[model samples]
Target chain A: MIDFAFFLEIIPVLLAGLPLTLLLTTASMVIGFFLALLLALAQQGNRRIVIWPIRAFVAVFRGTPLLVQIFLIYYGLGQFRPSLQAIGIWWLFREPYWCAIVALSLNEAAYGSEILRGAIKAVPRGLTEAATASGMSKLLTLRLIVLPLALRNAIPNYTNEIILMVKGTSLASIITLMEITGIAQGLISQTYRAVEVFVAAGAIYLALNFAIISALNALETRLTPYRVRA
Target chain B: MTNIMHILGFQQGGWGAALLAASSVTLALSVLGFILGAALGATAAAGRLSPRRVPAWLAHVYGTVFRGVPDLLTIYLLYYGGSIALTQIGTLFGSDGFVGLPTFATGVLAIGIISGAYQGEVYRGAYQAVDRGQFEACKALGLSRYQSLRLVIVPQLMRHALPGLGNVWQLVLKDSALISVIGLVELMRQAQIGAGSTREPFIFYVAAAALYFVIAVVTASVFRFSEARAWRGMVHA
Candidate 1:
C-alpha cells in the first residue's frame, strides 16, 4: 500500500517536469507524422529501387529497442565529435535533449509509417478512381482524396499510437533528460522511498493517458456524428 | 589495421564474443519471461472472468497498475526493491542475510510481470471471442468445467490468442532490452562495454541494433507462419 502523505509530497515536484514531458511527446509525434507521411507516399510502389531500402529502414527502426536507438544516437554519435565539429553540427549533438528528440522522432516515424501505410491501403479504390476520372493528377488525388479518407479511417488507431508515444517518452530519462520518470527516479534516489515516488509517477502517467483516451473518444464521436441505428 | 584487429581479436579483451553471448542471454530471458507471462496471464484472465468479486478485483488491480506505469520504472522498482523484499522474507524464516537476486532471474521476473498484464488482456479478449454457442453446447453435452475448457474451449481460444501472443512476444523481447540499465550483461550492456573500451559506440550500438532487428523480424515471420497455419481452414470476417 502506498502512503498518501508521501505521495502528496512528491506529486508537485514531479508535475514541475510535466511541461518538458508534454513538449517532447507532442514535438516528436508532429515531426514523426510528417516524416512518416513523406515516406509512406514515396514508398507506395512507385520507386521499386528505393522501396526495398526504405522498407529495410523501417524494419530496422521498428525492430530494435528505442532505448538502444537513444543510447546509440547520444553516446554513439558523441564519439564523432571531431567530424560533427567540422560540419558545425556539434552543438546539437552535445545536448541530450536534441538527441532524445531525434531518436524518438525517428523511431515513431518508422512505426507511424506502417500505420499510415495500412490506413492508405484501406482507402476505397473507387474513390481514387473517381478522383482520377475527374481529371485529377496522381498527386492531387492523393492529397485531396486518399489522405483525408485514410486519416479519418486511421484516427482511432493513430490516437492509440500517440498515447503510446507519450508513454515511450519516459525512456528518454535514461539518457539524462529530466522528464517525469527521470525526476521521479531522482526523488526516489534521494528519499529512498521507491514506492511513494513510483506511485506518484504512475498516477501522473495514468492521469495523462486517461485524458488522452477521453479526448480521443470524443474526437471519434464528433468525427462520425452520424451513427447507424441497430 | 592493427586497431581493427585488436578490436576484433579475443584474448579476454575483445567484445565480439561477449556481445554475442549477451544476445543469447537476452533471447533466453525473453523465452522464459514469455512462458511465465502466459501462465500468469491465464490466471489473471480466469480471475477477470470469474464471478467472484475478490478474483475480479485482483485481476483488475494487476492489469491497471502494470499497464498504467512505464515499464522502465517497474523494472527499476523490482531491481532495487526485489532483493530487499526477498531478504526480509528470508529473515523471517531464520535464513542468511541479504538474499541477492541474480541478474538473469530479476530480469526475467520483471519482464514476466510486465508482459503478463498485456497477455491477460489478450487472453480475455480471445476467450470472449470464442463462440457463445460452443460454450452452451459444451454445457448441454454434460461436460465438466475442465473437460469443456480442454476439449471445446482452449483450442479455439488458442487460435484467437496466437496473433495477440505474437505481439506480446515482440513486446517482451524489446522490453528485455530495458533490463540493461540494471547492469545485466545483455546486448545493450555489452554494447555499452564495447563502446567504453573501444571508444566506438557508433559501430557496436549499430551492430547490436542489427542483431535485434534480425531477431524481431525472424520471430515475427515465424508467428505469421503459425497464424496462417492455424487459421487455414477458417474464414475471417
Candidate 2:
C-alpha cells in the first residue's frame, strides 16, 4: 500500500523548496534576534512606562497563536491598504514573503526576549559589579563582560527558539509562499497522494531539525568548555 | 470605532455570538486534546521508565520524531492519512464505502500525539526529580508497588510536572489554531469566515486575537492556582 517509488521521486521535488524555507527561517531569526535584544535590554531599566509596554507586547504576541498573527499581519493589514500606501510602505505589506517574515520575526521577538531576559538576569551581579569597579563605562561593561556571558548562557534556550522559528515558517504556506510544506501541499493536490507527499515532507523537516539540533549542540559544547565534565 | 463596535455587537447582522461560539469550540478542542495528550504522555513516560530495552527505544523514537516535526505537518498527516488508513481498515472488515475520520477527532488525535511527545519529556524529568528515598520509604512501609505508585509517587510526580505541563498546555492551546487548516469551525476559521464576509479582516482578526488572549490569560491563572495548591505547605527551597 505504500508508494515507496513515488516517495523517492518526491524527495527531490520537495528539496527544491528547502531554500525558501531556510531563507524564511534565517531572515526572521536574524531580524528577531536584534529586536529581542532591544526588548530584553529595555526590560532591564527600572522605568515603568518602558517596562509595561514591553511586557504587554510580549504578552500579546505570546498569548495569541502564530497563525493568528500571520493572518492579522497578512490579510488583516491588507484591509488598511490605502493608509499603508499613504505611508509609502504598502510594498512591504503587499508581498506574502515580507508579511510572513514580519509575523515570524515579531512572534520570535516575544519569546526570544523572555529567554534573553532570563539569561541576562542569570548573569551574576558580582561579575557586572567588578567590571563597573574597574573604571569601565556601563556600555563597555555590557559589551565586554555581561553580553558574552549572557549569550553563552542563552544558547541552549535560544537554540530551541530557533528550531521553533524554522517550524513556524511552515505557516507561511497559508499565505501562498511556496516553502516545503507549501510545495508538499501543492504536490498532494496534483497527485492525490497525501500520505506519500506528507511523509516525504515530514522526513525533510525531521532531517532539517536534526541538522539544526546537532549544529547547536556542537556550538553549545564549544562555548562552554569550562563546564565540560572531566 | 463605532463601526467596529456595531460589527462586533450581539445584534442583528453582528457576529459577536458566532465568535463566542467559535471560541468555545477552540477551548473545547484544546481541552480534549490536552486530556488525550495526558493519557498518551503517561503511557510514553512509563515506556521510557521501563527496564525493557525495546519499549524504551520505541518511546525514544516516538518522542524524537513527534517533537522534532512541526505540529502543522502532524495535523495534515492525520487529516489526510488518517482517512486513507481508516478506509483500508474498513475494507478489510468488508465495508465498501470510505471511512473518513471526523475533523474534530483528527484534531484531537494530532494535537494529542504532538503534545504527548513534549509531555512525555516533562513527565520523565518530573519522575527523575522524585526523591530516591521516597521509594525506599515506601518499600520500608511494605507498600505494594501499585499502592505506593498511586498514593505516593504520582502526587509528587504531579507537583513537579505541573509547571512543565502548564507550558505544554499553552502550546497545545496555540497549536489548536492549526486545526483551522483542516476546516474546523474553531475561532481561527470563524474569524476567517467573518473577515471574508465583512471585508473587515482587521477587526475580525483583532477580535479573534483578543478572544485567544483572554482564554490564554484565564487558563494561565488557573494553572498558577493549581501549582500553588499543589505546593501548599511544602517547605521552601
- List, for all models, the DockQ compared with the true complex: 0.66, 0.74
lDDT of 1 by residue, A1-118 (tens): 6577777888999998899889999999999999998888888877789788889889888889999999888998998999999999999889989988899899888998999999
Error of 2 at B201 (Å): 0.4
Report, for all candidates in order, the number of backbone clashes. Answer: 0, 0
Q: Candidate 2: which stretches are off by over 4 Å?
A: A1-3, B86-100
lDDT of 1 at B152: 88
Candidate 1: where is the Cα deviation over 4 Å?
A228-230, B1-12, B84-100, B232-237
Q: What are the per-residue Cα lDDT tens digits for candidate 2 across A32-141?
A: 99999999999998999999999999999999999999999999999889999999999999999999999999999999999999999999999999988898998999
Error of 2 at B113 (Å): 0.9
Alpha carbon lDDT of residue B115, candidate 1?
90
For model 2, what is the alpha-carbon lDDT of residue A175?
95
Interface RMSD of each: 1.3, 1.2
